[model samples]
Target: MSAWDRTTSREQVLTRIRKLAEIGKISDTGVSRLAMTPLDRQAVELARQWMKEAGMSVRLDAAGNLIGRLESPVAPDAPVLMLGSHLDTQPYAGRFDGIIGVLGAIEAVHAFVSEGLVPQRPIEVVAFSDEEGCRFNKGIFGSRAMVGRLEEGELERVDGDGITRSEALSIFGGDSARLDEAKYAKGSIAAYLELHIEQGPVLESLDAACGLVTGISGPLWLTVELHGFAGHAGSVPMSMRRDALAGAARIIAGLQDLVRAEAGTPAVGTAGTLQLFPGSRNIIPERVQFTIDLRDMDMERRNRLEAKLRELIDEVAADNGLTYSIREDTNSPPRYCDPELMDVIRLEANGMGLQLPELMSGPFHDALALSYACPYAMIFVRSKDGISHNPQEYSSADDIAEGVELLYRTMRSLALSIQGERSGGKWESTTA
Candidate 1:
């Protein structure tokens, strides 16, 4: 018999995934639940119901994080074991990006409860809000708030519809005024674990069903705006016209050249979004705004590339006679998974007769945010074609089941093992 056949409810997990997909579902398979929207709240409510059924005491924190706690009879006040991923999807996204993680964790906890064996520490499953960051231009809002990592003026940031994050949080049943109350005291969390789709082609290429995350390459998000004089396209001369969009195009292309030079490494750069003022067929573009996403596992290399990219932007703007401004939206350094947790997962996978490949995640997860507060690890289910944040993203049921089984085993080990001590502000696990 297979190792997961008796533990996790694969069918039940899949059912809940399907049900949640139907909430803000766009295409037959696409989901559009942006953060803090009414549709996102509906999905949160559904997950809350499932958490209740799992014998958890659930609550929505002031930062809009949906948390479900399973108290440990042995040490109710001890540091809690947290497992979760976000539920918010990109504007045009697939069904399983962050959905499976939350559902899979709930299933793992439910299975644990069914055994009637008390854990050594409390367990909490969280569905972090705004992990997608499509609406407010900031991701991991919920997780960051929990760790007191929020920046000033975040509540004032406006979305496309002119709705501030503060207003949206209020409508979603969150009180930003009491956000400090949601912050978890240091050492209050023993560790964090997240299960998510690979979101890249690594596992499928290796023919592995599940992989272990070595570390996350946090992205540097920047918004650049260029200004120039607007004129009639027909009247603007080829050499004399100062076109902001032209300058933006050159900088975007130059960014590609900068990152591609470091080929064979994890370095990557993208200008995913762009906008132009007076956007007309005949009007010369006066202003252009675009976003930059630069990531690398190596901090020095990433910083170097960022400097070069900035220089490229300056050169382009000068050549085009355009003035520009840049705003740093988010700058997160790389975060590694705990060695102790990785060892636990490795042992669990070995016992299940599964081969787990170790890979670095190019895309960050909520685990990256929680990594600041506690030791964290991630289990990645094979993503078909390595496609994510799109309608075509998918992972097989068998693969997801395998990943969840590993998570369940890992959670059980950490939750029931002898408690660890906090040394030098880090949780040092004594468990093998």
Candidate 2:
């Protein structure tokens, strides 16, 4: 049997993720498991038990991340290695996104336990909270809090139906005290590793099993409100009207044009929402509000795009003689994982006979927030058709196991390097 086969079976990883999906499962091509909901609570509980079964003691921190720790043969706070991903999903999320990371971490621990394989450093597995941000109005809510990025009173942010943060978190444990306990002490972490599905078609299309990401994009969410007159739709002359909707319409069109011009290929913009004040059948929309999401992995490019988008909003708003103001819903700085760490992951994959693709991630992830706190890197298993945030998202059993095997090797390598067990600077040689 191969090293991968010896530690964890391909079928076992798939079975775990598929089974996690089946519980509180939905098939609308959308995953309805929101944060702290009954489904969400159940899934975390299930994985927590699995972590325990893998011979690691488990606990939930103030950030709601599930932590499983293995004692190092060395000592207390011995340089630690962290692995795992988020457990939350989109309103309609697929099976693998975050769950795969959690389960793979479990398997890695199981591998370590079964073989009595103790690297010089201790390893920890964590399942992050609210990574998908499908519920409670904030994605990565759980992670932001851990790194101390989430400010005081910010937890009061509201959701679509006016649901407050307190109300949302209440479903999980209803204790603010517990929430504070979830935070990671600054400087306590040695390094962080997250294994997640590619959530895109790149690896599958390339016939590769894993992607070594160099960077994860930062996200800028903008809300534009256009002010104008709401008059009778029928009697209003097109020439005399200052339609907020019309102004909003031009801005919307401009958004697409701007997105095309600026983001031509990998750059992306989404206007996922629009609202009118009265929303009446005959009322000329006097007020129109819309949302735009802009993302770029390159910080310079991301900043440029944000500045240009703001400039366009001003220009577009002015052309229609409409007053407009933009409210920033969220802004997460772009994250570039340590290239030194990325090279290690790639080397492990190549050593395991898997071709690794260098890629950039478009989605905003909890990893970015954690990156601010420590050295972070990720392994992406392929998703079918580049699909994510929906039920159609998928990764084959074989692909997931390959990603896990790669993570296992990398973790072992990092552990050795941290403990001074490995002599050379890095793992550069590969047999394959």
Indicate the residue-level lDDT of 408 in model 2.
77
List model 2 lDDT by residue over 232-262, tens digit each.
9899888777678877777677767766886
lDDT of 2: 0.76
lDDT leader: 1
Poorest 10 consecutive residues by lDDT, candidate 1:
420-429
lDDT of 1: 0.91
Q: Best TM-score goes to which candidate? A: 2
What is the C-alpha local distance difference test score of each model? 0.91, 0.76
| TM-score for candidate 2 | 0.86
lDDT per residue for candidate 1 within 134-253, as digits (tens), equals 899888999999999999999999999899999999999999999998899999998999999999998999999999999999789999999999998987788998999989989998
